[model samples]
Target: MKYYPQLTKRQAVSALEEFLAERAPALERFRQALRADGRDPDTLLDGTTQGLVPLWGWVLSGLTGPDAPACTDPATVPHEDWPSWERFTAETEAILSYESVQLLDGFISYLVRVVEDRTPTAQWQIGQHPNKRYQFRNHPVLAGADRQIFFPGPVASSAREVVRGRRAPANDEMAGYAQAVIEALSAEETRHEPPEPLVEVEDLGDHPIRGREIEVSLREDIAHEYSRQVDHMVKTLAMEDGITRVIREDREVLLVATPSWNTTQLQEWVTQALRDAGNDHS
Candidate 1:
């Protein structure tokens, strides 16, 4: 048995739709912006950009609308709250400015991570354990048994003859036949010509590199830097507030307060301390 993150395809799709629904107002604003710019309403809605339209359509098709029949499956998402595709498209387009693409990319990347986390990498099967095994005898010939005693009677005439033979050759005559076989194999090998090398292609400008490449692990580095910043902020708070230690678990930051200092008081103190530090930095 192997441990894996648990997520279903339906669950993933529903989550994405919910995300879009929550951002519906922002999407409406995007549509307004596009209309103000004198662009066609369907410019970004027709599923042209980055193949998002198909994904949107799939999500739309799967949703259970209010007028639609009730679904017993927990994974079947309700579309009562989801914005129409027209609004979603405008919102998606509005969010696609040069720098804003990173946000959309991040959302898609996170969804992929969620799916991968739920998938199993290893499989389970029933079989004998590797430590438990039984011994078996090897073939007599393979085990180096004497050829004369173990040989299956004499070879039949049809089996022994490569070229038509009047009868099976005697053991003493086999040497001449073996020599002839070797000569025939050598001649066949000599007749095969080696393949020629591929010709080099000309350097045409058909495929051009569009943008300058920078070497950096963007996602990993950003995550690491964010963690470092958060850790430093917590450490600063601990020093200023006379806290002993700070613990981090996933997205949570914890500080154990003394009996006299309640969690609410501690939270306020930390919040104020962060604000004061920000002011000082400014």
Candidate 2:
């Protein structure tokens, strides 16, 4: 999707209000249809309703493009010319069976997206070693699950300076201070230690253990060495179609299977482990 020009929070909010107002008549008609059909109008319009997608899409279409209104006073913008109420009602009546909550949810989700797109990703600077200009830009963290706008390539001391100067800087001023601190820290040539590696176990086999309970205990001496292996085995059992709960305490692991799990498979896995361990020792 083409990135729309960024808007300040206030502007974005005003634009959303205007967009909603343009669609108010049709949305109200949709609500009336729900009430007439013996559905609670208020209860039906929530985040999970499916009918809101097309409506949100229509709203977005108007907000994008070169001819799109500038982020000025909404009152000054010409009102969108909507289709007559009779025509709109006839078209929307076919989909009145869908829940209203999902439709509202779609609008909310799109609004959030529009606002975030305008949010500055980062602020930083440019220059030579000592007198560099500060800047800011968006950097991805948490595997892109989250993003923060701050000075790129900042050192520990500089980061500390940035943090110390402002416990929480205003949005507009954050970029410069963050970049300045990062540059100062970089000049100090601070050293950083590598992060610790994460240890995780993966499932090795599939079985239906959804609701069955089982416990296994390991000797303390071998717990560290075999914890990963044990964890993998437990996960395999837990993932079985009906397994519901898995609990671990020190060297012991417990599992609970729901009706969907196959207890026989659990038994077989345990027996196989015993045989494998015996063979290894022998």
Candidate 3:
């Protein structure tokens, strides 16, 4: 891990400029990794934007690991309380594929270090805004009986043909059809459309890039209006565009599945993640 010295408030403007100058390569890499193509982190601190969160804090947080004081016990016990930086990064692969739990824990731990050291949180931030590129895994095309059939996108005809087959009741009939539909939609295609953000992040000052974990847990009472709500939302977004999930009920069980989503338990979490990300910064 690269060590980044913290910038003090008392530092001269030249010092600040020099500080950024020294870190340009590292920060620019972060910008690419974050897809933060809009503004330089804190380079516009002069007046381009006021109280705009400096992105440096996020960078430090990314490089640092969880501090031991963050644990329930005050006494640190090496790996038990805190893992080494090498150990931390080795398992995490933070930039590419760190899981959500690792991110949350690491972030909170970094906060613990900041608070323990009496460091100002604002120093960590530089000027920058997020520009996330949402790439959903699969496109959805809803084909329901007695409902307005939605067949959109390049592979729409193929998926439509699969749905047109008899809704025969055999063992795993729904599962079979779901797989067929998935296969049909899996046809290779390219699109440049970006999904609209459901939750807006406006002038995130001294907070976070992801203001909150945008996740949706299906209401336990989905049998009520929630299922209808889900169906409606899915149908509305199922037209010829960059759709990545198709909603189909088991005719037998609409919102019933164990250990996974959909009747065949085929739908992946990306569908819900994409929806939640677009829905809110919540």
RMSD list, candidates in order:
32.1, 21.6, 25.2
lDDT of 1 by residue, 256-281 (tens): 32323444455455445544545222
Winner on lDDT (1 vs 3): 1
Tell me the tens digit of each residue's lDDT in model 2 across 1-282.
100112222232343344344355545665565576576656545422232333333322222222224423222333232222112112222211122222332333332222233333322211111111212111111011122222112222222233345323222232333333333433433434332212112122335543334444333334465666666666665666656666664553344444544445554554465345442221
Question: lDDT of all the models against the reference?
Answer: 0.29, 0.34, 0.28
Model 1 pairs whose backbones collide? 5-118
TM-scores, in order shown? 0.19, 0.20, 0.14
Which parts of model 2 are misplaced by more than 4 Å? 1-212, 218-224, 260-265, 273-282
Once fitted onto the true fold, the runs of candidate 3 whose alpha carbons sit more than 4 angstroms away are 1-24, 32-36, 40-282
Reference-based lDDT, residue 85, model 2: 16
Error of 1 at 207 (Å): 63
Who is ahead in TM-score, 1 or 2?
2
- Candidate numbers, best TM-score first, in rank order: 2, 1, 3
What is the alpha-carbon lDDT for the whole of candidate 2?
0.34
Q: After superposition, how far is residue 37 of candidate 1 from its true place, in Å?
A: 38
lDDT score for residue 167 of model 1: 41
